[model samples]
Each structure stands twice: as structure tokens, then as C-alpha cells.
Target chain A: MEEEAETESITLQDSAAGGRIDGKWGYIWGAYSVTWVLLVGYTLSLVLRGRLLRRSSGVER
Target chain B: MKLPFAWEHLIGVIALLLFCYGQVFGLFMVPPDAHMGDVARILFVHVPSAWNAFFVFTIAFVCALGYLISGRKGFDHALEAALEVGILLTILLLMTGSIFAKPTWDVWWKWEPRLTSSAIMLMTYVGVVVLRSVVQDNERRAVWSSAATILASVTLPLTYFSVQIWRSIHQIQTSPADIDAPLRMAWRINALAVLLLATWFLARRWRIAARRWELGDAPPLPEPLQPEEV
Candidate 1:
């Protein structure tokens, strides 16, 4: 039973290493890039709209 | 014309810097998950975005109730701003979740209970925004949107607990006790950063809505540029 458990652990580690070798970095990068773009873009849109509204209302801050 | 720096500007700058710091720490300093490998880093942003989405929805729900009770236009403006930010955060949550799913679940999308409920919530709020636009009278718009917001918020709690309540491929919600110390730290930091950023955005949006409300229906248009003098 102990030997069997050892082999199973080894197999798990091997598969994990294989996943790293396969390089799924693209997925990670994609997720981060998309998040950054969406957040920054939305914030910029809000800022611009605020400026436009202020200009239109002629409310000098 | 250069605008003077204000407290909101300071808050915005601090929020941006803190978020960047959190991202760097999360991506590089925290150890990768044994099962998920480096891809687990996505949790830094994804979880926080989901939390903020829920938070903003709760704000919208409260504002909706406030409007009903007080009949104040300010509450309506606050409701609309919160709803708008909540929608944006929900979209971010969905997109990030999809991206994370592709690697971890080996599928880009799934029609599981959590995903389905979240999508429904997103659509319901989106419908509220559209409903507000379609209605012409201010009182009618406020009444309709406030009612819709309250109705839509029912899905928020459902979506939050879907994974636990139903059979779902999505992982159960993580708590500080469940995560490693370093990961917990990074997650908490990022959560705070996102919350600050959301607060800044919410403040600006609420102010803009209030200003428009004050301006009434006919806001003056910009004057056309005159021809240069010969």
C-alpha cells in the first residue's frame, strides 16, 4: 500500500511538471491583459464623460 | 484647461498604485497552487472583481430601497451609478472567469448554475439601464428602474451561493482559512485595491449623475467656433 501511494504521488508530480512544460502562460497572460484593458478603458470612459458633462454644464470646479 | 487636483484625484492615484503593487505581488511573490500551477494567479483579479460586483449590486439594492422610501432624486442617481458600476464589474467578472476557465476547466464556457445565474443577473441589470433610458418622465424612470433594480438583486445572493447550493464545476468560495498565508495576503491586498478603485469610480459617477439631475433637461450645447479674424 505504501509503495502504491508513492507511485501515485510520483505520477501527480510528473503530470504537474508536464503542464508547466506545456506552457499555459498564454491563458494567464490573456486573463490578466483582458482584465487590465477592461478596467482601464472603463475608467477612462467615465473620466471623459465626467469632463464632457462638466463642460456642457459650464460648472467650473 | 487644466483642472485643479482634488481629493478624488489623490484617491484615484493611490488606488491605481496600490492595484499595480497588488498585481505584481500576486503574480510574482505568491507561490503557485500545487494543482493549478501559475495560472492560479488569475484568482488575484478574478475573485476581487467578483466580490466588487456583488458589493456594488448590494449598494444598488440599498439605494433602490432608499429611493422608494425617501422619494429623493439623489437616491435615484446613486442607484443608477451603482447599477452602472455593478454591470461593468459583472462583465469583468464573467470575462475573467471565462479566461480562467479555459485553462483550469479545459473549457472556455460552461452553463453551470453559478455561470448561468450570474449571466441572468447581468442581463437583468442591463435591462434596468435600458428601461431607464426608454422611459421619458423622470418620476416614471425612477420608479421603474428602482423597482427593476430591487427585483434583479434577488439574483445576486443566488449567484453568490450557486456553487455551494448546486452541483457545479466551479470551485467553492475561498476563505482566508482555506488559502495559504501568502496567497491570503495577496488576495486581501488586491481586494482592498479594487474596492478603493471602485469607490473612486462610484463617487465620480454619482457626482456626474447628480450634476445632470441638477442641470435639468436642457443642458446648454457648446458654442460653435467662430471663423478666425482676417
Candidate 2:
């Protein structure tokens, strides 16, 4: 019981000092992953659409 | 024969390199925020996306005005491209902002002034795009869409200033003094990277629009039925 109380106090102190919720790295990584996925996917779609349009129109760069 | 180089290609390469560098610097080198900790890294992407959305919308606004004044098809095409790219970036901004808010604000969404105004601005432009698709006449579509684009752009400034104009939980725009040096550096680099990438996308989108304008929107007609079959 004494050791449990000590650990709880340390956790409270850490939270107070940092002003951060512990174990929020998942949110951080999730945000970054979603961002990259959207960016890459959108870019690919743009490129493929452009290519298809060029082919259909018989336009050459 | 290929010239072996183009300005757009060069910009794409440079933007890619700068983006990689900025992401590396931001994700690995910059220290976490005192309050938000690692979650603050989301700002590197979120802020740049917001800025690019604003930048593209501004371009669209100018193009719309130009089309109105000169009646130029080029301006209309440019407006179309910018509106598309701007909407895409705005969607990205909202998604990233929501993701950041989840941990920081303990909510996935909010109807605060800034957030609400951004959603309105996004939907307004989206409506403009949809308006264009449903209108069949080229000249009529151009005129109507340009008008809508200009009217929708009024919301851009509102969205930018929403945090200041209303009581809100969202943080106000930060000044240079408020940011740490390394984080500011990362932010600036990422901002430029997004700007360049946006330029590339705008150019490509514009080309596609111009090509479509030239080719016309009519579907290819089916070959006449065979005489024997008829």
C-alpha cells in the first residue's frame, strides 16, 4: 500500500510538471500516418488522372 | 525529343527534398512542446496545410476577379484548379486539426468559431465545384463558378480571424517570440515545402483544366449502328 501511494504521487507530479497526458504518442503517430497517406494518395491520383487525360487527348509533353 | 528538364519537375524535386528534410527535423530534432509534448509535432503538418489552403484560396480569388474583369478562359481554368486544390488542402487541415485536438482538447471535434468558420468555407468552395459540374454550358459555368468563387472567398478572412473575433478554446496565432528557435525553423521550412508542393499541384491541375477546356466536356459519341444490324 505504501509503494502504491508513492507511485501514484510520482505520476501526479510528472503530469503537473509536464502538462501532458502520458501515452499520447499513439495520437501523434496516428496524425502523422494519416497525413502522409492522404498526401501520397492524392498526389498519385492527380498524376494518374493527368496521364490518362493526356493519353485520351493525344497530347504529348 | 525531350528537353530533359522542366521548371515544374525541378520544383517537384526540390519540394520533395525540403519536405523530407523538414519532416525529419520536425519529428526527430525539435523538442516537444512544454505543454503538449510530442503531440505538438502535429503542428508541422497542420499549420502548413492551413497556410497552403489559404494561399490557394487567395489565388482562386484573384483568378475569379481576373475572369470577371477580362472574361478570359485561362483565368477560369486557373480558378477551377485553385479551388480544387484549396478544398483538398482545407480538408487536410481539418483532419489534421481534429487529430491534434483529440488529445489536446479531449474532443474529436468542436463548433468553435475558427473550426466552424473553416467548415463553412470548405463547404462553400465545395458547393462551387459542384455547381460547375451540374451546369452544362461552358460560358455559363465559367461565369457562375467565378461568381461563386469570389463570394466564397469572403469566408477565408473570416476563418483566419475567427480565433481573434470570438471567444474560443483554440489557441490564437503564435508570434515568433512565442516559439522556440528550432521549432520555428522547422515550421518555416515546412511552410515553404508545402508552398512549393502546392504550386506543383496547382500547375498540374491547371494544365488538366486547360486541356479539358480545349477538348470540351462532351462524351465521345457511339459509332453509328451497322447498316446491316439496323
Candidate 3:
């Protein structure tokens, strides 16, 4: 049983590593950057909204 | 209340700055892919957006659960805001993924497991939104929205495990346990981006809810009475 499990694990590792490194690093990175843009944009939006809310609330301290 | 740059807001800003730094490192400095060329760059955006959508939805679900268990209006409002942001992120994910898919798959759409599950996930969130809008009273809206949020969580696990549960052809290059050096850096950056965005949206939405609460339970402004004949 242990031997069977070992073999299965090796096979899974092999399958996981089967892919050749594709040459499209640019697109992969671009997709990542797009996510960053969204994040930054959203953060800025929150900051703006927070400011608005505080002003409206007029709660000191 | 006090100037909006509370500690949380400051932390959010710092996190966002770090996220930007990561984006620059991931996009410009990262080496190109040997197989997919520049198109591989799409993963930086597409993967992160998809993950963020799921993260937002999960938060929404938890908030809804909090409301159900504790009956806090804050939790209800948080659930609503989280759902709103989740829907936005999900829509962005679908659009970006579609664009990425077109070049790689040689077609506009494919009924693949991830894509299909994501569609279902989106539909469930939309239903939650509709339920919230239809309800009249604030408490009723909160109750209905919370229920919808809780129920919609069913789609979350499905969307998350869809690839593993089914035989998916889409490449599963990045796993947390074992990541290649280059891909690892890129993935980390993408994650940072998601975290920053999620924090920003949550904080902003929370503030909005706080503001609404502070305003008290006043009924919405009656149609402005036209100035009575002067």
C-alpha cells in the first residue's frame, strides 16, 4: 500500500511538471499588471470616498 | 469621522503602494515566456482579478453569516458592499479572461470548467443583488441580502474547485505549494494587487455604511416640495 502511494505521488509530480515553459511571459505579466491597476484604482476610490464620508459625518475626534 | 486617513486607510495606502511596486516588477522586469510570448503577460491581470473576485465573494459570505448569527446591521451592510465589489471584480475577471482566451484558445469562448463555473458564480451574485434591490424596508433588505449572500456561497466552492473536480484542459501552472522562481514572483505580485484592491474597496464601503447609519433611519428625502408660490 505504501509503495502504491509513493508511485502515485511521483506520477502526480511528473504530470505537474509536464509543461514546457511557454514564451509568452509578457502576456502573463500584463495580466498581473492589469490586476495591480484595478487594485490601485480601487484603493484611490476608497480614499476618496472615505474623505467624503468623514466630511459629511462632521464627527470631530 | 476624524479625518478619513484612519490607521486602516493609511495601511491601505501603503499596501497599495507596495502593490504598485509589485506590478512594475512583475510586468516590466519579469522575463518573457518562451512558449506563449507576450500574451503570457495577460496572466498578471487575468489571474489576479479572478482570485480577487473569489476573495470578495467569500468575504461577503462571511459578513452575511455574521449578520445571521449576530443580527448586526454593520454585518449586513458589509455583506452588501462586499457583494457589490465582488460582482464588479467578477465582471472584470470574465472580460479580461475572455480577452486572454481569444488569443490563446483561438476562439472567443469555450465551455471550460473554470469559465463555466465563474459564469454560474456571477449569476448567483446577480441574484443576490436583485433580491436586495427588490426589498423595501431596510431590515427586510438586510435580511434578504444576507440570505442571498449565504446561499450564493454555494457557487464559491464550485467555482474554486471546478478545475480540480473536473478534467480541465486549462493550464494549472501556479500552485501555492510549489512555484517556479519567476512565476512565483509574478504570482506574489498578483496576490498583492488583489489584497490591496480588496482592502480599499472594503474600507470605502464600510465608511459608506457608517455614513448612512450616522444619518439615522430618516426616510429618504421626499420629492423636494417645489417652492410654494413665493
Candidate 4:
């Protein structure tokens, strides 16, 4: 009986986690993720530009 | 004669302090929106970024005009500083707006009037930069760029009011007459954030310009750039 209860509890926890994950409005997740990706990409571009500028200036010198 | 002063570091320090203070105030002190819950917190970043983008463009417009009228290197330097800062701030504005839109509007991207107009404005400045690269003569580049900047400035008001003039997916940026207290506080924090970012970018870009000039690679502000030899 104890083993059965333990299994039942585990199943219930798994279902609860699944519900939380699936129940969320999917569009919100897409919006947040896309924004994060774009912002990071832009930051990387800025860094690369700075590095290139530095390299080219060094070459000129 | 007294030497020309550059207070780049001093301005940067002040801007950094403001950003820190704005962040703290935004995340902690501002009350959450009852309708949108804690997700509305993103406004603290988004609204400020939009403001800075507009403000920087205005500075670029004015500086471009000054450069054309005075034919001075200082004005050109100011215009370049404003352009670099404006582009970065415009990018920040778009990123923040899209991020904030998710919880509020339920979409990552929308064909909203304000959003479309702002994107076009940014692209126009980018076109100006490309045009400068294609032209070999410095004087011609400056003259053409100044014209572009002037045209861009004239469109600023229309872009700002586009939403009001036509129906859009977005609402008016800010309306104190309608907003509740919690939302108002959030908007104030956003305003502070915008000011902080503007100061920071302006100072940093100015320092970068100064270093470029010191390195002797930057185009002379007063002398028009001559055509390059093959």
C-alpha cells in the first residue's frame, strides 16, 4: 500500500508540472524569448564592431 | 590659451549612477499593475528606451543643421556622436517594446503604427550612414548627410503622432488622465531610466569620438574629406 501511494504521489507531481508548463499562454513565451535573443544578438554585433575597429586601426598604425 | 575640456568620464559616472538608481526604483518601489500583474514591470525599461531614442534623434537633427550652417568640425563631431548613440538607443527601444508586448498584448511582433514608423526612422538613419560610405568626397558626404538628417527630423512628429492619427495595435505611449496610480509610478521610473540611458550613451560616444580624433584617423571636422586614390 505504501509503495502504491508513493507511485501515485510521483504521478500527481509529474502531471502538475506538465500542466504548469502547457497551461501557460504560449505566445507570451515566444515574445519573451524572441526579445531576449534579439537583444543579445545586437549586443554581440556592437562588441564585434568595436573589435573590428580596433583591429583595423592597429593595422593602419 | 585655455585648452578645450572633455568631461566624458565625469558625465559617464553620473549617467551610471542614474541608471542604478532608476533600476532600483523600478524593480522595488514602483507598485505592480493590478491588470497585468508583475509582467508590467518591463515598462520601466521599454518606455525609457523609446524616449531616449527620440531625444537622441532630435539632437542628431539639430547638430546636423549646425554642421551645415557653420561648416565646423565641432558640429560634425556632435552629429556623429548623436547618430551613433541614437542608433543604439533605437535598437534598445525596439527590443524593450517587443519584450514588454508579450505579457500585455500576447504577441512577439505586431504591425502597429508606432512600431512600424520607428523602425522606418531607424532604417532611414542607417541609409544615411550607407550613403556617407558610398560618397568619396567629405564635403559632399556631409552636405548629403545633413540633408538626410533634416528630412528625418521633419518626419519625427508624424511618427510620434501616427498612432493617434490612425488606429493601431498599440495605445498612446502615456496618458496620465487615464492611468491608475500604480501605472503612473511605473511610468515615472521609466522616464528616469530613459534620461539615465541618454546621458550614458551620449557621454560614451563622445569619449569614443575624442579617442578617434586623438588617434588621427577620424575625418577632420573642419576640412571636407577628399576623394580617395585607388
Candidate 5:
């Protein structure tokens, strides 16, 4: 089992070492970009929601 | 053009700073992985989101129980807040997982146990939200939503353990100690930042719930630490 696992990891390393996987920067960029945009958008929405709530309720904290 | 940052908002500012630092470090300072190269960096955010989503959902589960037991509006508000933030993180987690998967797993999605369980988790919380919206009566809404939240939360542990139970293709839960030095540092920093960020979001959401209650949508919260029956 350990030998099989080691062999699999070696194959993974070979794939990563080769230029075949070099272009995976797209996936990395996509993941991080989505994270930032969604988080920022959510935060903005919360701020907007808070502003509206304060305006409608007339009580600011 | 900005309001003064209050003491309560300090955690959020700090969280944002830490997030910036963590992301930069993860993206540039860390070495590429031997197995997945730079693509492994996605785990810096994806892992944190996944863990924190579970943490926030666990909070909601506790709040649900608190509401069911005490009939306190505060608990109800907290439950609502936690669920909102939890759902947000879950979306972030799943979406990033997809983005990461396409390259590594060679598919945007698979009906793997982990992914399937996460879908169940998301829909259950959404159902709780729908339950809240349809019930007009405050008491009924609170009780019904609280009940639904508790039931929905059962899926939390299921999703959390899905990888382990089913031997999923999804990565198993890992401890920082088990990781290499640089990767562990990035992971730890990002995880803390995400926790603080989620806390800030939950606080803001809870405030919104309170303002909503004050606007006569639901009953007002009882005195702090004095959770009266709803």
C-alpha cells in the first residue's frame, strides 16, 4: 500500500514538474478572484443593508 | 466619505488586513507544491472557507438549540445571523472547490460524497430561510424556523464527515501540524483571517436582525443576558 501511494505521489510530482500542468495558473487565479469578489460584494451588501435599516428605522448605533 | 470606524468594527479592519497579508504570502511567498505546483495555493482560501463554514454552521446549530430551549429573541437573531454567514462561506467554499477541481480533478464537478453532502447542507439552510419568509406570524416564524434550523443542521456533521465516511476524493480534514512549515503558516494565517472576517459579518448581520426586530418585524430582544420567553 505504501509503495503504491509513493508511486502515485511520484506520478503527481512528474505531472506537476512537466509543463503539462504549468498552465494551471488559470485555475488558481479563478479561485482567488471569485473568493475576493464574492467576499467584497457580500461586505458591501451588508453595509448597504445596514444603511437602509438605519434610514428606515431612524435609529443609528 | 466614510463613517468613523467604531471599536466594534476593529475586528473587521484587522481581519481585512490579515486577509491581505495572508493572500499575498500564499500567492507569492510560498513555494510551489511538488505534487500540484501553484494550483495547491487554492487550498489557502478554499480550506479556510470550508472549515469556517462548518464553524459558523455549528454556531447556528447552537443558537438554534438556545432558541428552542429559551424561546429568546436574541438566540433567534443569532441563529439567523449565523445561518446567513454560514451560507455565504459555504458558497465561497463550494465555488472555489469547483474552480480548484477543474484543473486537479479534471472536472468542474462530480457527484462525490463531499460535494453531494454540501449540496444538501446548502439547500437545507435555504429551506430554513424560505420557512422564515413564508410564516408571517413572528412567534410561528421563530419557532418554525428554529425547528427547521436544528433539523437542517443535522446535515452539518454529515457534510463535515462525508470525506472520512465515504473515502471521498475530497481532501480529508487536516491539522496544521501535519503540513509543511510554509504551507502551514499560510493556512493558519488565512484561517484566522477568515474566522475574524466571518465574526465581523455575523455581527453585522445580527445587528441587521436587531434593527429589523425594532422596526416591528419581530419582537424586540430582551435585556442582555436576560433572555425572556418569546
Candidate 6:
């Protein structure tokens, strides 16, 4: 009986997650991921550029 | 690890923490809109990016005026940093706006006044940078770019009021009554986070410009094509 109850609970949890499966979640996830990825990527580029400039110019400060 | 410290890095860390808080709150805690549902959550980022883009451009405009008046490199460096950051934020605004539009508007892009004016505003600043690259003299580059920035800034206002001035499919600004208190809080938190991030960006970029000028390592210009001997 406990095994049957566990299976039922698992099924219920899957249905609760159905919102993510809908197409709308893809848009939401894509927007958020892209925003962060681009922002972080630009930050990294600035860091790299600064280092490159420092090294190339031989300014070891 | 004893990391060598800079105050700007501290600002960055704080901004990062706030960003995570705001992102989680908007993504998970906030309730979905009645009509737009989960898609409305995107405005938490998009609206802030738009506001901050306008903010930086305003600073850039003021810096341009300062440089013209004072003939100071300080103003010029600030102007350069602001333009680069304003470009980044505007790009973010447009990209996220398009992302939000795909689900809600059923199109990745639309030719509405708000969207069209925004693209022009972005191109205007980018053009200043491109023009700066072409001019060989440092003083000429600074003066011309400042003049260009001052003139181009008019587009910023045009972009801001495009929806109100003309018939646009894009929705105008929403009032407090339009959303719940929690939604307002999420938006404000994200706005602050983005503002700090932009400040850090401006400071870092300004330092780089100053360093380049100090090192006499400004970017090399292409030599004008030599006339072939007849």
C-alpha cells in the first residue's frame, strides 16, 4: 500500500511541474538565460581586455 | 585567499548578490499576470535595462556638454565610458524586449514607433564611436565626438516618448495601481541591481580609457590611401 501511495505522489509532482513543459517556459528561460549570459560575457570581456592592455603595454602595476 | 582589493570590485560583488535576489524573486516568488502570465516576468529586467540605458545616455549628454565647456579629459573619459555602457544596456534592452515580444506579441520584432526609435537611438551612439575611430587627431576626435554626442542625444527623448507621441502597439508606462506591491518591489530591486552594475561598467571602462591615454596607446588609425604616382 505504501508503494502505491509513493507512486501516486510522484505522479502528482510531475503534473505540478507541467508548467515548465509548456512552451511559455521556454521563452521565460531563454530570456533570463540570455540576459545573464550576455551581461556576464561582457564583464569578462572587459576584464580580459584590461589584462591584455596591461600586459601588452608592460605596465606591471 | 587574500585577493588584492579594489573598491569597484566590492561594488560589483554587491550588485551580483542583489541581481541574484531580484532574479529569484521575479522568476519564482512573484505571481503570474492574469493575461500575460509568466511572460510578464520579463519586464523586471527589460524595463530596468531601458530606464538605465536612458540614464547613462543622459549622463553622456551632460559629459559632452562639460567637455565642450571645460575642455577637460575627465569629462571626455566619462563620456566615452557612458557611451560604451549605454550601448551595452540598450542592446540588452532590445534583446530582452524582443524575447518578451516573441511570446506576447507573437513576433520576434515589430516596427512600432517605440521599437523603431530605439534602434535609431542605439545606432546614433554607435556611429559616434565609429567616427572617433576614423579621426586621426586626438583633440579633433574628442571635440567632434562630443559635438556628435550632444546632437544625437535628441533621439533619446524621441525614443522615450515615442509611444505617447504616436500610436504604438507597445504599452505605455504602467502606474502603481496596475501591479501589486510585490511586483513593484521586484522591479525596483532589479532596477537598483542594474544601476550598480552599470556604475561598475562605467568606472572600469573609464579607467581603461584613462590608462590608454596615459600610456599613449590610443588605437592606431588606418593610413590614408596613398595616391598612385602617375
Q: Which candidate number has the best TM-score?
A: 2
Better of 5 and 6 by TM-score: 5
Superposition TM-score, candidate 2 onto the true structure: 0.87
Alpha-carbon shift of residue B26 in model 4 (angstroms): 1.3
Please give, for residues B127-226, the per-residue lDDT of candidate 6 as tens digits. 9988877876666777999999999999998999997788446766677786798899999999999999998999898887776666553432323457
User: Which portions of model 1 show Cα errors greater than 4 Å?
Assistant: A1-22, A59-61, B1-5, B219-230
Q: Name the runs in model 2 displaced over 4 angstroms.
A: A1-18, A59-61, B1-5, B220-230
**What's the residue-level lDDT of A59 in candidate 1?**
46
Q: Residue-wise lDDT of candidate 3 within B1-230, one digit each (tens)? A: 68754656675667767767766766677776544445655666677777878888889988988988898888977887898789878877887687566656655578988889889999989998899766767777788888878888999888888866774545543556664578668867867766775776776787677665555543323233578833
Name the top DockQ candidate: 5
TM-score to native of every candidate shown: 0.86, 0.87, 0.77, 0.70, 0.87, 0.85
| Candidate 2 lDDT score at position B122 | 97
lDDT of 4 at A42: 48
Residue pairs with backbone atoms closer than 3 Å in model 2 (clashes) = none
Q: What is the TM-score of chain B alone in each candidate?
A: 0.91, 0.93, 0.87, 0.81, 0.90, 0.91
lDDT of 2 by residue, B95-167 (tens): 9899888877778898989999999999999999999999877788899999999899999999999987884
Per-residue lDDT tens digits of candidate 1, residues B44-158? Answer: 9999999999999999999999998999998999898999999998998899889888866667888999999999999999999999877767778888899999999999989
Q: CAPRI verdict on model 5?
A: acceptable
**Candidate 4 Cα outliers beyond 4 Å, as residue runs:** A1-61, B1-6, B177-186, B210-230
lDDT of each: 0.84, 0.85, 0.70, 0.64, 0.85, 0.84
Candidate 3, position A56, lDDT: 49
Q: Model 4: per-residue lDDT, tens digit, A3-40? A: 75575455434433322222232433443454345444
Which residue runs of candidate 5 sit more than 4 Å off their true CA positions?
A: A1-20, A59-61, B1-6, B218-230
* DockQ score for candidate 1: 0.31
